[model samples]
Target chain A: MNRLFHLPLSPFSRKIRIVLGEKKVSGVDLVEERPWERRMDFLLLSPAGQVPVLQLNGTTLSDSTAIFEYLEETIPEPRLLPRDPAQRAEARRLAAWFDIKFQREVTENLLQERVNKKLMKSGYPDGARIRAGSANIKYHLDYMGWLLERRHWLAGEALTIADISAAAHLSCLDYINDVDWGRNAAVKDWYARIKSRPSFRPLLNDTVPGFTVPSHYANLDF
Target chain B: MNRLFHLPLSPFSRKIRIVLGEKKVSGVDLVEERPWERRMDFLLLSPAGQVPVLQLNGTTLSDSTAIFEYLEETIPEPRLLPRDPAQRAEARRLAAWFDIKFQREVTENLLQERVNKKLMKSGYPDGARIRAGSANIKYHLDYMGWLLERRHWLAGEALTIADISAAAHLSCLDYINDVDWGRNAAVKDWYARIKSRPSFRPLLNDTVPGFTVPSHYANLDF
Candidate 1:
């Protein structure tokens, strides 16, 4: 059996969950981890102490993008990455952008303001930072809207790893009403379709302490 | 002919340059770009205004990792990525760590205080951001020392894309004397090997109009 240490709201963890479900990998135990608490065992498993560490046959893998690629290569079923190298490069590039840029600009802000504060985690919320996040998020959302307008998914017509990465981060923000779906009808529609998947059902049900999701957060149609 | 739009001292750009040289790809015409000048054409090539955009066969690709992967796929002569999927994943993860985490901590500080401040091209520097960058850089350097003690390269024994990514960033900082080589012997040794590479020659020679590199910048054996 494979074991995964994850956080309910972590975008990286959600990327892994989506990959696992898409790949149809069964018998995997998902353990919710509070990384801030800093469990010694978890630290051993992941020196960085970040979530979405996959433990299989005594080998522990960290980093969501890395884990996703590893799973794609190991499983090779319902392939998330394209067989063509150019397409694969495109997927990886989009995944990196979402993981690094989107997370920094938007998701982290929402998490910091909503979850981190509630959790009493490190890093205080500055008004300027939050405002900057909000402003930056609109630009990203507009970019996504442009991409979604041209393709069925985030990267392209194919439902590749890029979609999963974007969805994971955006979904987390959506839960806290950080995303303005009203900003782009195309992006909103795209999210609506992916959000209805069974894999996303668990994510919608996740309730972080002291944080109340909006009414539409769990709505499949949302 | 392949075309590359980049700033000489930009770490991301330097990484691509090394990869191009390592792969033995020819017909690369490098153009130095002034992103802060905000040229309309440059903006069209890359909306983010970040450099290291690779132009091949009428297709423009932004992001160093993406461009490098594209080249690896197209050429695949001297591979920067690992043959094994797990190893490849590790390479990508470490590359991301250097590009984002290390950049936020180390490169951004040195670039701002020592480079950006000197370049009247980018406007005045923010003291608070520079101070934060300096503090963060020391912490990152400490982490690098710990990692170098365990592995020969940033990621593993064999030089991979991660090594290039790390060297690119560190070399930029080295130019401005931001790095304390005496702080960690292990890191210094690792960097010395990287600095001696023929591919790193172009990076070391890079000079800003108003700024000069440190006295030790050109000494490969230093």
Candidate 2:
């Protein structure tokens, strides 16, 4: 059986889970790993000591993006990236925008401070960081709205990994009630569509011990 | 002509430059972009406002990894990624190691402090950050040395994007004389080999104003 070491609340882990769910690749043994613990055995499996380490086909794979690429190559149904090279680049670029840029500007500030810190018992959430996260999320939501206004999806007409990546991060923030869906109607409408997907269903059931899942988080109408 | 908007000291920019050079993709009109200035035209091209934006074949692409993937898919000759799926994953994993982990732990602490601070006029170099970066780099070098001792290249027998990514970050650190190359013989050997590649030659000649490149920086024999 394939094994996936992941954290329920981790966006990167959620991204892979959604990807796996999207392709209907089931039977993956989901093992929740707290990467900060730096368990020696886990480290042996993943040198980076990050979450979403997939043990598939006798291969230990880390890095969510690499894993996604591997999965896409092996399982080509419902292609997440567009066929055109330019479209593919756009999909990847937006995926990266959420993973790298939005992660830094929003997720790190909100989720890492509010949820992970408490889960790990690292330290009290810095009030300033939370404030900054609150401030930054507006810009991101507006940016997403702008893009959605222009296209059906984040990248283009076709649903792509860009949507998966962005939704993964947003879902995590949504769990913490950090995202104000009302701020941008387009972004909210987009999320409502994403939330209804079967691939996103598994994430709705995810529960982090200390953090309460927002009531609207799992609601299809939300 | 195809255009490349880049900054001299940026590891991300260097990664793409080396990739372009490696595939012998030439005649690109190199445009130095100060991303910090947030030129509206550049922002229109790259919403992320990042360096190493590639304008090729009427496509405007940002995000170094995405650009590399596009190039790899389009230009199959002298394949930078291994043919095997698993090997490709490994290459990508290590490439992310440098681009994300190493950048945050080492390069951001050192180069961003010493070089970008001056270029962007952001602030004075933080003593604590430089100390942290200096301390962090040793572990990274040791890790690289360990990998080199086992495999012929960072990923496997064939040189891949993993090497290019690692070299890109190391080259920037090398320019600032932040690397203690003497600390790891295998790493030094690996870097020496990477430094001598024809693709690497362009990066060697890159000069950033207001900061002197170390004497050994451009030397292949160093």
Candidate 3:
């Protein structure tokens, strides 16, 4: 059986989970592990000590984007990237925008500060980082809103990994009630569309021990 | 008629430059731009306002990894990634190790603090960050040495984008004379091999106005 080592709130792990669901790939056993535990066994599988490690075909794969690309190459169906090279690059560009830029600006500040700090007993969330995250997320939402206004999806007409990547990061932020859904109508509508997908169900259902999910978290209408 | 907007010491820009050279994709006009300048025109091209933006085939591509993948897909010869899906995943994983992990832990701490602050006239380099970066790089170099002891290159036998990515970051640090080359022999040997490549020439020749390159930076025998 294929197994995926993940954390409930890790956006990278969530991105891979959605990709698996979208591709209709089955037989993945989700194993939740606290990366801060630094288990020697887990370290052997992922040198960077990150989650979203997939064990398949007698090999372990770490890095969410790498795993997503591997799945796209091997499966080739329900394509997450466009056929045109330019379009594919655009998709990847947007994906990186969320995975790297948005992650550094917002997710790390909000989620890692608010949630991971508690989980690891690291300390209280830094007030400045929280304020920065709150301020920065509005800009990102506006950017998403602008993109959605121009195109049917983040990159173009198709729902690609770009959408998955964005939604993954946003969903985690939403879980912590950090996102202001009312700030951008277009972004909210876009999230609503992606939220209704079956791939997003498992994420909505996820519940961490110390944190309570927002009332609207699992609502499709939300 | 291809053009690339880049910064002299930016690791991402350097990686793309090396990729273009390795692939022998010619006719690129290099335009040096200060990303922090946030020139409205440049921001229109890359919303993230980052460097190494490529203009090719009437399309503007941002994000170094996205650009590299696009180049690899469009120009197949002298492949920077392995043919096998699993091998490709491994290559990408290591590439991210440098691009994402190392960038956050070391490059941002060291280069962003030391070089970018000076270039942008932002402020003084924080002493704490410099010390942290100095400490962190030792672990990274040790990790690189461990990997080199097991493989011919950073990823495997044939040098891939993984090597390019690692070299790009290390080269920048070396340019600042921040790298302690004598700390790891295997890593030194690996850097020597890559530094000798024709693709690495342009990077060695790169000179920022205020900073002086270490004497051994351009020398293969270093």
Q: Which segments of candidate 3 are over 4 A away from where they belong? A: none
Candidate 3 chain B — worst ten consecutive residues by lDDT sum? Answer: B201-210
lDDT (Cα, tens digit) per residue for candidate 2, span A39-103: 99999988989988999879889999999999998899989999988889999999999999999
Q: Write the per-residue lDDT of candidate 2 for residues B32-92, one digit (tens) a residue.
A: 9999999999999998899999999888899999999999999987899998888899999
Name the lDDT value of residue B78 in candidate 1: 81
Where model 1 places Cα greater than 4 Å from the true spot, the runs are A121-125, B117-132
Q: Please compute DockQ, using alpha carbons, for every candidate against the native two-chain complex.
A: 0.56, 0.88, 0.89
TM-score preference between candidates 1 and 2, better one: 2
TM-score of each: 0.92, 0.99, 0.98
User: lDDT tens digits, residues B45-154, model 1?
Assistant: 77567788888876778877778878888888788887887678778778877887788766776686667666644567677777787677776677778878998887
Among the numbered candidates, top lDDT falls to 3
User: Candidate 2 at A143: error in angstroms?
Assistant: 0.9
**True-vs-predicted CA distance for residue B102, candidate 1, Å:** 0.9
True contacts kept of each: 0.58, 0.76, 0.82
Which DockQ value does candidate 2 get? 0.88
Candidate 3: global Cα-lDDT?
A: 0.94
lDDT of 2 at B99: 92
